[model samples]
Target: MRQQMLNNGQQRIGKGLQLSFVLLISGALIVSSCAKIEPVVINEPAYLRVFNNLRFKVTVDNQDQTHSTLVMLINPEYDSNGIPAGAEIIGDFLVTRNSYAPPYPSHIGNSLDVYNPEYPGKERVNAGPILNGFDLSSWAQVPSGQHRVAFYSRPRSEVPFFNLEMRYRTEPIVDTVLDLRAGEVYTLHVLQKDFNTKENGILLRQENFHKLALADSLVYVNFYNMSAKGFFEAPHTVKPNSGNHLLGGLNLEYDWFQEGIREEMNVFYVAYDERFLRQHYDGTIKPLASFMTHLKRDTENPATAPYWSLPLFFNAQDSIRSFLFQEFFFSRPGFDATPESFMIPNDGPEGPGAGGYARLLCYGNGREEPPAPRRQNYVAVPNLIVTTHSGEHNPRSFATVNSIEIVNNSVYLTTVQRVYEPPVY
Candidate 1:
């Protein structure tokens, strides 16, 4: 089977079959906000600024299970036949900042009205909502970076709701660039700070509260080998029901039959279904307070890996026409805010939508650009930054400055090009 498939791959490569795919990257940036100061009482001030907007090019893989398997089966139960269907995913993910900021308002309200800290308040009427999910047609254009990207997911019960407590995996911050395509779900959540604007002002700051999802059913990953000529294609699919089967012990055997294959070869693929178990939906999986809590506790059991593995699949075929099928089934429907439902309260920084950031920024080079993404083409999560006082308010206008340059964790004095001063409102 392997020999036949490899031969088929060679032929496909000869024909230049471009195999489509996807990947995701996470990174961070250091930014400082400059706010106008008015004579006011003092406190330990932390400035809220627009850090670079993170650009993640997510590429979905068919074999790399370690990073793709966000959830896996623990202990499973099967009936007379073996058919995997459901399992709870338990693992941690990382979040990072973007290199470019989208056209969205800062969660903080505009100057005329103050944003409410507790509630998001009414979304602005004039603002057009920005879709924050996946874009497949142009996954190859994302640049490289070093930082973290936030991860989020909706629960099985609440398809319309986001920000499930299981969202926001924080560890494993730094890594290589990511490539993303269709037939995958990428969660993006934001984190920012909010301040109490004096007055009956309603304010909103981009907090880590909002969670988003990029629901791409089939993404294409492109492979490059400068040394090799022609393009090759090998189609595969992520087994949504891999580890979780139906009432019997019967699991699904993925089948691929193409037009060019010889009749002598069998089309059977072999990879253990370990991603889900029936017990997950039956209330056997325990929910923890957070993934960090799971990581902190010490436990030894060979049955469980220290972290959850990203789910991936392997496909075997000797045919040239069978295209890959990647899909995430929904027994329930997904929800999103309409243009009317997406708005920021008055009194905080105006969001990109309100400030005319609803479309992708034009990087004009005299080239005709692609069309805008369709509304149904993407998903967005509303991120809200939250804050609480940890120390007494210092009502004095005194300033303290410190500087040092570090080389290999060692510090040295250096001249300053700019000084950071917090915004005082």
Candidate 2:
């Protein structure tokens, strides 16, 4: 797919910090300084499909070079026509002879120019500009259905822009009837598996956190794009019997530099243990009905972090819960405060810190189940958090960390939340 807006000044704060992070791990940060993007066009355009074997006649679209386009599938989300929605096309074959030169200044362009000591031009591969290879694949587990694929060039400026054409498969859906009853709780274990990275590794911001539905209570789910990096990469290793460890990453430091770093990060998901939730509340999860979000520190770069949600509202009447979860009178228009806070506490003295769950305001579409007091389902909307912190190496450098909070509300489903099935994947 074509690139969305990539020029955000908000990200500049982190570029320096990222460079510093690289420097600390490698003793020095490297830069190709002199890389050129050359486009290549194959005899046939690269073709991708839903669930089938494909041999794309890849082409490098550039000037004066027969650059090989490396294609890797990404974000495998299929459209109504069963084609990939988006993928990353990086240009690693280009090189710049000079880092500090006129015309080619040091700017973070779509074509990333990283320096590698072992390359022919001492220029490691970076995405974009010209000949960077493109990753074209289906999103993890392309839904078994018919969907359209969106094909387009990205970043706006390639030596010459290319067009995308898609191929798809059509099928039928069969329904099976199973005698199932409502009210009785069903135990479901959702395992989110994906690949990690050598740079900023990926972590499961959420695991099979607990979700309980009493008979016919409603449940709403929301999903959001947290980061552009590591969203679709996977096939990482996990420790024995560790369910929470779906999110993982590679050590860019060790991978880029020659470090003895051989171990990978294994993050475990905190399951919605009936015993734990029961221990925290009563044995029943419906009683503690609520929405929640918390922050988790990134082990690789403590400055970077992830936020999580805890059940916030529960088996209460909608009218009352709605009012309770409503935005605090003092909340900013954009909700730029503590995410997922509430104005009042469940049961406390009325006033300052005495009243509601500070900042626990619920907005957007909700599910319809049994009445409030009998409500069984709890949904979390989607939202995002962007944090800017001081860099570890260059005090002048700063890092901007963005996290996606797919509460049952707005971030993703926030705008689409409604009274029906929980909005989860």
Candidate 3:
């Protein structure tokens, strides 16, 4: 009986040992599987978009090279004091190069002539010229930090102007420093404040370029106010006139003061009305004749509507401490009398319009040509100062709104031009 009892105890101990071994092996397999699993990684890239809003027309006598500006993005090696040792050319873009005649206006021209350091005259491979008005579809990948930008103008050889050493001469324009963050997109607007002085300035604006999943009814618009003069010491406010009251009633989505760099206004709900009209030459008001008629919102095809609006209004202070709209007013006669004639139409769907996000820029500088009609009803619409006759780079004119198709979530630019005509009694 004792021997049997001892054998039973041994069997029970063997079963217990087997269960322990199984548990240990199971735990080891679980840890090994966990170690083999890898974490998923995602890469985000930095992007840059540049716009040559400068009015520097490079024409030789009668020749029109209005779009000969060359833009470059440089990444300089910093010294111990955090200063750049030498700028390394990273991006080269040629803007508004081709002849933009009537019918098909082309803003994409040639690439910048990048001479190789090792072999002069040999062009280096670079991301080509960005089309004027439109965003750089191809994002320029750059390091997330501060960077320097330079602008150059290619000499027009037609006038026998010869720079034996260099094909292009660098403009006196000041280099711009940008603080870029990883996974963010930036837009740099190179503007020439005064064509007479050839003064240059830059406006830097940042954007979130991440692809968004938005509802079908929704779209995004961004406004950039680049109309303010940078070189002039005097305030950029418009000269006091009664016309300023037109804009006083309308609330702007976003307005950038001369001191402000850039701002992203809140997203607006799509809305449009045909209540706007232009005054005819014969004391008649024509409905939907003005550029503001294009502000209508289309739901079935949002691309047919204006997504972004940039209304440039200058304010001048009166002795009475009141503000008035400087240049744009109502009661102007003749179709050509108002600066509205110079505005490029927003290409609608199936039309030449770029479609997605429509950018409308309304500009007027209080200057009107001789034979100016007397101001009546406290309404006056001044014509934009025509700095360049080339028609491509009108200093007073607004940038062309490229057609953008809203297949997915996208951003656009827009502006407003108000016209006041007496209501028919």
Candidate 4:
């Protein structure tokens, strides 16, 4: 009786042990079936901006013609199944900006305008809209490292770049690689090095767009000499024939610098013409800013190499406690209404533009020769004297400037302006 009882108890214990093992396995399976997971993808970023300054000469119907219009394409994306997503248009209808001042006002119906009750949409408009400004809300992000870039000439028309036919992409003016560093900003310039040879290429330069310290009254600036090799030469100054089929025999009478107008010559800064040369010869006048031809491009880091500075306001208060302001850079030539510096390059004063200046008593006046730029004309004309202030009511509202980029005598004043202003200060 005792042996039979022990055997039965042992059998029961074994059954219980088997049941516990099965339950433990089932519990683990249940937990494994309910497991959760989350996956993510992160892209390292670098910044790049494009400028299509390509004014290259192309042979059209056996005639050479120069154009500034360009369409740029960066690394296009592709899907996982080896299907093309689309070619991204990094830059489209990009032409070198002629004059960046007195920005094209945004009328009432502009899409970018906001609601202002006091200043009705119809009553007042945004006075300053940038010329070919980029969206500053977000910098163009790309994975750091090498990027293939290409520039093609497209028709200057209402059509978008992608809608254009395959003919436009047949001939790429500039196709190159732009190796960028992570967390760095850059500007890719498509340029024509020489009009004679039409040597087209790309130049990538690291850019610094941070505003300078706004504490003191100052106007900050820097200079870049992106002039072509044939600048001031005949090949660049003279335009090729567009409709000279009638002048088949007399080819000498082709369209060339007609009406005393020249292109891509010396760009004078302050006086625009002779003051630049005279200032160097005699120490009578020093320009607020001056850049000699063949000026070297800077490769220094932005933080270390700050911009050149100029006074924002002139304090001419003697005893009456009156504060004066400068209206025109070249208010009256030779007079100190402008900065104490007046001399500009003898050939141009470095044309900022053709506004705000008149022929004010200098070598350029009373000359019988064509109004074309002279080699050493004593007094020069000014493009315009730069103003320190561009605001009406706010004294601290200094003229907003980001970069003064010059390419083929076309100046681009790029501003990283804020598009939206919150209601509260």
TM-score of structure candidate 2: 0.21
Q: List residue ranges in candidate 3 displaced over 4 A.
A: 1-44, 57-68, 76-87, 97-137, 156-172, 209-214, 219-225, 228-425
The TM-score, computed over Cα atoms with residue i paired to residue i, of candidate 3 is 0.35
RMSD values for the candidates in order, in angstroms, are: 32.8, 24.2, 22.8, 20.0
Stretches of candidate 2 exceeding 4 Å from the true structure: 1-153, 156-294, 298-361, 364-425
The candidate scoring highest on TM-score is 4
Candidate 1, poorest ten consecutive residues by summed lDDT: 223-232
Model 1 lDDT at residue 113: 35
lDDT against true structure, model 4: 0.40
Residue 318 alpha-carbon offset, candidate 4, angstroms: 14
Ranking by lDDT: 4, 3, 2, 1
Candidate 2 lDDT by residue in tens digits, 161-212 = 2232231112111111112122111111111112133221112222111222
How far in Å is the alpha carbon of 132 misplaced in model 1? 36
Candidate 1 vs candidate 4, lDDT winner:
4
Residue-level lDDT tens digits of model 1 in 66-156: 1221211112222343422222211212112222121223332544433211111122222212223311111111112222222222122
lDDT comparing candidate 1 with the true structure: 0.19
Q: Roughly what TM-score does model 1 have, to 2 decimal places?
A: 0.15
Task: Point out where model 1 deviates above 4 Å.
Answer: 1-42, 50-53, 62-425
TM-scores for the candidates: 0.15, 0.21, 0.35, 0.49
